[model samples]
Target: MSRKIKVLQLQNRYNVNASDLAEQVIQGLPAERFEVTTAFLRGRPGPGEPESRAARSIYFGFSQSDLKGLRLRALWRLYRLWREQRYDVVIAHRFKPMNMLMLLNRCLRIPACIGVQHGIGDFDRAYRRWEARRLLTANWRIVGVSRAVRDYLVGCGAGFDAGNTVQINNAIDIDRAERLQHPREQARSLLGLAREPFIFGAIGRLVPVKGHIHLIEAFAQVQSVYPQAQLAIIGEGRMRAELEAAIARFGLGGKVQLLGAREDALQYVRAFDAFVMPSLSEGLPLALLEGMSGHLPVIGSDIPSLRPILEDCGGRIFPVGDVATLAKQLGAVLNLDAEQRRAEGERAYSYLRGAHAIEDFRLQYLQLIEQSLAAERAAL
Candidate 1:
């Protein structure tokens, strides 16, 4: 019988989306052929510890605030663990964890490393671009969560081997998403929202990159024509003060509300007349998927990261960061009759189910691992 391949999944922190993807990957792998463990490169576990669903989990203590100090501490600690376990593969998600694994591979000559690029914006920094070109050297493969990210990495001269760089989009749980959604009336009641107002909802971090300011601006414009319209933004971030000021500046105090972060946020998706994501950048956002899964017609920025999904799922798109265009799109959707809006949403859900199945995502990762392992053996 063939020995089971032991794999380690690493991430900088256990944020919701990253953790979810890691858990799905671990859960989906064939038990007889693979064993998986997960580790976080920074931060201590909160309330319920070891959030990832792996056979085993570990935490490597290193402060994110101190880059030089982190390198010394993480490198020493990871080396000790790598020598002891001798894992067959180490799949690192996001930039910091990937960079750490690449450095470790260079020094200790340990396991085969896989770097997963969950997004694309990080390379904007000179230091990150330099590190990308200099550090990644080993038996390694890099997976981008979207085609745009893969193209961006190669365009930046990151020196990733042409043959090994690839794209595997983040997958969604269509069944779970559909089950989580409540009926429109019940969902509104659950959130203490009134049904009379035409709700335009958005869920994302309130950071500048999310373009909440622009969304708020666009919604204010939509209010000029559709006075009954209200905007509800879920999630919290450092930009609250600025966003609040924008609301006041536009005199949308009563019309717009920052709902903040809610654990049950996705359940309330159906409460909205339509869902929108005004992100300036993204790599297959999970919120968009959940919105579609709830059968809400979507409106999003026409950035490369979102085009593939919007084009397939049949949503309205506006130019990135253009408030007037977004307002125009919002007005167009709001003008649709209930039946017309429902039909658009149904089309989106059908496309989402057909294209982004969680099982297919799992199978692709498994195949990648198997091929990587086989290539390694053949080389020897």
Candidate 2:
């Protein structure tokens, strides 16, 4: 390669999760090996901002409207941007950029165009079909955060080269998260959470697919068994009103609090006795990993993506959308003796550091880029 691998990261403003992970990866990479620049479909202030500084150029556009209109404007702006700018590689997050990326890469001939799947959640049929077409392109790499996603694409009968897909699980710096364990009492004191409450927390957008509602239902079941419990959900989304209503309907207003996007969430991760993700669909969620890294016992929905991460890590896995099953599992896990839960947490940490190590994952990504770029140069 003649120059540093200049990767142009394309993202939507609403893609808070993907952007956060991308930025962290960029910052975490060896500086001499890469140059990461970003272009946001609609940029706003949120958790993904600070670490995105590695990007030599940052392009911000796109405004949040309903999903459909946002898609339209994103397509137009992206094509224009591709025509105007130059990049060695383009890494896009979300469906919009992926849809037009083929044409843009064809026009620009960027050696690498990688797509990062941030989550396993999806919308209606039209959206799924649209996603398939958006991701179809030659010499493109699709990094599915979970094996389920990689398999989904293959099963859907998309006409792309089968080998083009890669399963790159989302990873985090667990060392930092381990340090977040400053003393459970101290973390609780900082968050003003009850030092004695058996606090359970979920961090992510409170959308339907996130299955926050399901978690709430499970918590309701849990409350019947353990009275000294409270649920703290971190992050905001469209389902705020609905979720708030659910909390009240269950008469859990006092027991449940929707804390929107905490700045010191990792630090506060220590306060929670358990980290719950009742998501219906996911692509190896980062929150689950963070939860495990913080040594919080994980209780995840039993799904392909989730099972691969949580099943054997002393993390309890339950069936997706089966409220009764999730509730049963939740009650059982939450009721474990303190020592048993702590031992489970230790197991989770060891598994996370081994399978989802940041250094290994990052190196894999870098290797992909290097090999791809090398092949391109050889062809040239």
Candidate 3:
């Protein structure tokens, strides 16, 4: 902790989870104690924004697919740049270059290397056999955002040191989400929602793994009984045309709206009676945490990572693709008495603030960073 930690996060370029987390970390850091710098694989900060106090935010690639052919080329460029700089520590995030960095770290002896697990990916992830084996056979420290993920690594025999695998839940900034002081009616009208129907919403990039199609079908079943409840999904994804077509096919056009990703994610959440995340997989979803922070009780798919987080809140969980069960859970929650619903929202919000607020997460990052640095020096 004596030297200013210079962290080089090899994460995504589109400013999603990793970038968003980095931004909050900069804003929340005890500036006097930390100096941060970054190297991403995409776009630059826009228009003189001081998002990071680092000397610069360098881009190595702009899109996920861009890394395929030029990965080695990108690493050669990054290594040259890194060689000129002396870093106290380097924490590489997920995949490609990060994996590449960890694989080559022994040769560099970069002092300390940390790898953050984004999720307990599906069976398909076994393809990273060499990298997984390298982690088991090498000296890198591993961190998972949720305990479920940590357990998965241990079960897989990833060979992390006994104490090297740490569980750090992703954090949320409750204050940011709390800004939605607008009345529910106002939120509904603003989002072009009917003034009186029950609103059920979910947010995430519209990918197949997100389980959006199942949610659409589940909501359709729920509307059969209430006819007054509506589902609004907020996110931008390649599946828009297909999702829209599915909604029409279900004859739920009047009951569902696909509000593609928005500037303020909570704005749409504020209009919901309850939020839903039917993800087949996740890394401690930010959407569920944010929705709950906004005091919207949630219904999630029963996945290993999300189950433990939701079970305590009277959160309802159904089988991954069970439309009947999912619809039943949604209907039951929406049918609660006004006081009961308010109490549930309050409980959900309290759970979020207690365990997952943004400030809490920022502090956790600093602690982990400082701890990793200390561990290195202690060994010396």
TM agreement with the true structure for every prediction: 0.91, 0.82, 0.88
- The runs of at least 3 residues in candidate 3 whose Cα sits more than 4 Å from the true structure, single-residue gaps closed, are 1-3, 16-19, 43-53, 62-71, 122-139
Local accuracy of candidate 3 as per-residue lDDT tens digits, 1-380: 48665667666563633336666656565766665567777766666544454545666654555567646666667677668776666666665545767655655667677777767752136556545666442346777777677787667654554577777777766775677535688877777888877788898888898999999988888888888888898898988988999999989887889887776677567788888999988875888887887687789988988887888666778988888899899888978988988888889888877877677777777787777677778877
Least lDDT summed over 10 consecutive residues: which range in candidate 2? 61-70
Residue 8, model 1: Cα distance from true site in angstroms: 1.0
- Taking the tens digit of each residue's C-alpha lDDT, what string does model 2 give over 166-234? 877667777766765568889778766778888888988878889999889888888877888899888
- Comparison by TM-score, 1 against 3, better one: 1
For each candidate, what is the lDDT? 0.83, 0.74, 0.74
Q: How many clashes show up in model 1?
A: 1
TM-score of 3: 0.88
RMSD of 2: 3.9
Q: Where's the lowest-lDDT run of ten residues in candidate 3?
A: 122-131
